[model samples]
Target chain A: MTSLTPMVAELVDYYDDGEAARHFQFRLLDQQQWPPPEPGQFFMLSVPGAGEIPLTFTQLPDQNQHWWALVRRMGSVTSALFRLEPGAILGARGPFGRGWPRPGSDQTPVLLIAGGCGLAPLVSQAERLLEMNLGPVALIYGARSPEARVLGRERDRWQHKLALFEVIEQSPGQTARRTPLDALPDVLAHWGHEPGATFMCGPEAMMTALSQRLIERGIPPSSIWLSLERRMHCATGTCGHCYLSHRYVCQSGPTFGWPELELLMQQPVTTQTPPLLSC
Target chain B: MIHYRLAELAELTRHLGRTRQVWQRSGAKEWCQADASNPPPLEAGRSVQSAKGFFFAEQEHIFEFDGRYFRETLPKPAPFALIGVSSCDLVAIAYQDQFFASDPHYQARRQQALLVGLECTVPCEHGFCPTVDAGPAARPGTSDLVLHPVGNGWLLTVTSEQGRKSLQGLNLTTAPEAMKQQRQAQLADCERQFPDDQHIRDGVQALNAGTVNASTWQQMGVQCLSCSGCTSLCPTCSCYGVQDQSADQTITRRRFWDSCLYDGFQREASQHNPSDDAGARVYRFWYHKFSDDFRKDFGRYGCVGCGRCEATCPGVIGIHSVMKRISQHD
Candidate 1:
């Protein structure tokens, strides 16, 4: 792939999920063409002067050749993206990294878990599985509160397609408040953990804890997958910014099976936060 | 192998200077892009700056965009010849050649340049090339041409077709067997003179065995100001970051050398950084150099033992100091 060249894409649609996240849909310029991005794969999105940042595909390219992403305004680039108008032109490179693995057969069940904005990639995967008529699919999503839940408008449509369990950690009303992990045992019992695949996208602590719990529940490490986030620049393997020991997150993965991530999980968490920069 | 007097070698430099710029090690620790009119002095050891930037480039515009369309900014460097590069840097260039094998920008410059390597008969201060199998003498095929100082002249061996073509018009005679033997003796003497590097060996062992504690790395991190001096001077550091700049509605995306020592190197847009701590960053940097897992990919340690990091690091956290500290921690 000619990933070094930044192709221009025009913003066609814009929407907000909450106070923290914004979603944008774009159409690639006439000269640029890319295959529909797979779930969990990402692109380096940029606006002039704000610098480039990696964003996973929230929606694959549709019949009209439009793609979408969910971006949170936690840093400079996303802040610039949040401020852009519908007609603004943005620069992008790649539909990079290996995405989530496809199911082996239509009979194989699927389980998806997500937290906060981490639900973006899982939603993409859920859409694909439902389209393929994959049997017995389920999603366990957690958020801080009902107001903070992303994609709240799509809850009814999602509930119609699969077994979706939405939980809020802190809610004011009579609705039950629980973490995704708290509801996992019943979900595992219903699906019979040995015969299905599990996918997760969330905070490191959450993923680490969930993966270990899955393993303890007799799920194979190879059958569990996670999407990871790391600082990236080249989005190709040339730049070493995203190196996790021997693997470059931009190349080897934004998605990896639990077995592949076991060693990286062992590294101690450092509290030092980097200074704000667009890169 | 062809033999030429020192003056005759200077004459060849003058000839090449007529068409292409010629660079060579001059002064105590610098390289000068000289011409026939001013032939460079024949110095020993490595130059202050590695030959990395010549091919990989410190900063390059990969592409540019106006409001309308994107244009590729591939490099088109003029033909040039580098003279008298020592073996350590030559090996590093060869290593980078493998890393950037398919990269068009690197290939653009590499294809236009000719490499002339020099065999070191004496080790320079703070160098341990032999330990990494990088020299005392230049390795075969790492350079286009290799020059061995023998007697009062030089023994020039053409290692590639490009080397033979570069010297097509300059007639020279074949050297006798005794000259080759003299070159070997000099290299052997230089290798013997390198001070013992038991500390490096012990350090690598400790790193692999997981014997070096986190507290030691934390202490070393406190000393590092993250000036990026070590990575800038390191012959094997190839990390880079990309940025875009705009003026008058036109934007250019450029890639510049980035150091892993920087705090933001592994920080995500969500502000979650894997290598956030200075100690962890320091550990990752050295781990990349000494890790056995990397050896499986690159066929050797990333370090070529040029010791440029040791000479240039302001924090004194270069390979020598870091390794020495690790080795003595227990």
Candidate 2:
């Protein structure tokens, strides 16, 4: 999806929260050249002054307005993208990476776990699953708070197809609030195990804990899939920055299953002193 | 093939230096004096760095992009002949050739280089060239010319057409008995210094075949600072990042070396970190060297056992030692 294409669309709507922001709609400038994006695919959006960044597709599988990117203003690339107006030129190439599993009766019930921005891809997957009429899907999402939660406008769209649970960590803007990871037990119990495949995306600590909990609940290792993020210099595998044990996060995966638990959970942590994040 | 006296050899090295700075491969800046016990004036030991610095320079520009224009350019390279190169380094160069030469951008820069090989009379203690079939000495196609120490003089074998031209300017001697004797002694000395390479291959094999847990890798992590020193010193590691520089209208693209050990290397715009911890990052280094892709490309292992990384590493976490430890584990 990273081929250079001019995408111009109506700036339909824009919403901004401090940490992340969402663009409701974007027009694909070159619709004729726009290639179809897989459900789990992503696009590399290029901003002139800043640089290029990878964002997951959020608008439904084959919906209108070309594509959508959920940008979190944490880095230089996204911060630059956030400042662009509706008609501004945003260069994009992608819709890359392996997407969600094809809807099939061959598999059991499906469990989707998302935390914070982790919800981006799952939302895309949920929309596609409904179009295919594949169900009994459950969407389990955890966030710091309800106000910080995103896609409230799209709530009605999800409620009809998937059983949705939004676990908010804090009590409205309270300083002393719990994290969504702290409420894992309730989320797990609410899902009620019936041997279904699971897809999880979010922070590493949260994903690790969630996978462990699901494993204890008797879910098969092969049944759970995980999307991971590593530092990436070149979204192509050549840079080796995003390289994991035996995989390249940008190449082999941003996704894996329970069978790879050891590669993630068992590997030794690097001792290189990490630089503190400067504000 | 031709022969040259010690004085003639020294002059050739001086001439090569004019093309580019000729630091002896793995040689320290200082020279070793001749002792009564060791007659020939030998340069101290081999340098702890590889020839990688020449081909894939520590810092390189691929392209530059500014507001409007970008011109693609490579670093200005003066034709150079890297002498005293080990078989291991040559093999490592072979691996790099597969990488850069495969791409037209890299091939352009590589075409400007030359190789001068030297046979070792005394191999470095840490070097394990024979195990990977990289050396006790230079391979056939490794260099344009090979210099074998012969008695009081040297046996210079020209391996390429370019080497023959380079030798045209030199005053050389016919092969003599004393030179033959010196060559035999050098070969014998290398065998005595390091007899077999099976140990290195065995250790690497063990690490690959074993299923050691994360604790082992984590334990090794205590000493690692992720300084990127190890990666920088490794000859076969070819990972790099591309940056663009542009001004006014023309744009240029450039590539710089990158290490997997850095945290920022994998940090995404979303602030999600996949291998944020040390264990996952360290695992990446070992896995790449032993990965299926590296093996398929090189026909064996990616590491040539030069030991430069082990020597320069502040952490003292030798890849050879780690492979051995993993192999010993159940």
Candidate 3:
């Protein structure tokens, strides 16, 4: 019988990352049956008293069965997760959902777009590209402010190797609220190459706007990928909570090509409705 | 497939009740445990509540975690028989069987239950089962035994090996071969008696053609109180939410019936709600019930035309009302 019961994972360590986010490392008690998770795949973390919440793997599990994720203290489950001390036990089940496919090529430039805490799912992919010595790879990470930015450590390491653009809504502590779109022109100009594939995660409006712009710039919807977040209970796809139309976002994707995502969102209501800000 | 002269349904029920619990449809919406000697009348009416609860319980503890280990909780229900279930409900049970085929907890309860489907001889107030391919007569293979009322007794068609085995001790005479044609005639008459549901057919078309306006849905959505009444009463709605209750370090995870019409049903911990708009949630609920994409997976539309939702919904978004509104839009 397939079970929702999760194997115990103890928190090894954690440190404050962004404004209300923490970088957490955990070591699973049992790894004998764990299928190696691809970057961008997520897991369900159970806070003993509070319920379960889905989190992506910012860092894949290593030899010691230690994996890491960048978690924002968003609600009950994450709040409970943040309250626990190092070595505190929690439950986890996953490596669920479709992850990012391999980049087209190291020689083919890849563009990365992220908004605020949305960077978590794409951070590992960026790091892997950097490690591969892939050139012309660019990242545009938009945040409310410098302090509101995340993965500061990962950014610092990639600065010399990456075509990085840290676009903030409020620049130098305070400025007119700008957006990633305001910086898209300059970022693309500097990269000076049409990206072969674009990976994105962020606010719904930001992702949709960027995807449209990319498609207008000659990128096929098939080559543009984005990670979507939805409410999920049973990651096994039995529970219908995470439906992106008929498809379960927890099963078929958290990551999807723009074309596939567009097709899934073809329900009449979605098109008629204006974009609403999504967390 | 076999025939039997059921001299008395009570006699057959009595023999089966010896080893298994027998629950027969009672009143308009309950299945009361029956006394073998005096079985309740098996009227050809719909049950607002179905046999769904017998397998996929409304609330259940799925698992428990106690510091060191997590243990799953699977129900072990005793062998039971559902007597005089209407055809629409039996079809819903068949649909759930395929959906929860991999779910062990559902299987444990399902495997022990023998379904006895009762064919409708006349249309019930809210039912239009024939329109959705569910029936006045039970569809073949949906139940273990199908009962068609004939003369002063019943014609029991044994559809499964389990049904045949359970009837071994019943003192039934062989039914006349002409009874089969008589059974067919009664079912056809019942089907013809169902009021025309042209709106339902047109609404299905309008829905699949994507012609219904959001404004119409919003109007209907406004009437919905999110009381979860329709979903609660719906036989095929299988969405659920999980909760964790902890005491003395033991965390027990419980799952309860959840409705997609509720705003929080698809709300994430990040406070992002996929169906934040009531209209969207309303549309999604109907979409799940009537969408052709869903039909491909379940072999039929999610709705069995039982009209439980129509009977229970306090709002105008019940199947009939919504279908009329949407089809009118077309």
RMSD of each: 3.1, 6.9, 2.0
lDDT of 3 by residue, B123-205 (tens): 88878899999998888889999888898888999999999888887777778987888999998898889999999999999
Clashing pairs in 3: none
lDDT of 2 by residue, B1-330 (tens): 454555445666765555554544334323222122222233423556677877777766544444332334545665656666666777788778865554444555566766767677776767777666677667767677777766555677677888777666556666666775677677767857884655455656655664656677776666678888888889888777655444566344456787877766666665555556676666667766765546875576777767776676777667666666666654
Give the TM-scores of the predictions, in the order they appear.
0.94, 0.74, 0.96
- Evaluate residue B327 in candidate 3 and report its C-alpha lDDT on the 0 to 100 scale: 98
Write one digit per residue (lDDT tens) for candidate 2, span A1-279: 121222323344567643566654555544434467766666656564465566777773244536566766777767766777766654454556666666577555787878777788777777766677655777777776666676665556778777787776665556654544555567557766454778878776667777777788777777888876565555555566666655566756667776764464444344343431111
What are the interface RMSDs of all the models?
2.5, 5.8, 2.1
TM-score of chain A of each: 0.89, 0.83, 0.94
Best-performing candidate as measured by TM-score: 3
Off by over 4 Å in 3: A30-32, A131-135, A270-279
Query: Which candidate would rank higher by lDDT, 1 or 3?
Result: 3
DockQ, computed on Cα atoms, for candidate 3 = 0.62
TM-score (second chain) of model 2:
0.82
Tell me what fraction of the real C-alpha contacts between chains A and B each candidate also makes. Answer: 0.62, 0.35, 0.65
Which residue pairs clash within candidate 1?
none
User: Against the true structure, whose DockQ is highest?
Assistant: 3
Question: Candidate 1 local accuracy as lDDT?
Answer: 0.81
**Candidate 2 docking: what grade?**
incorrect
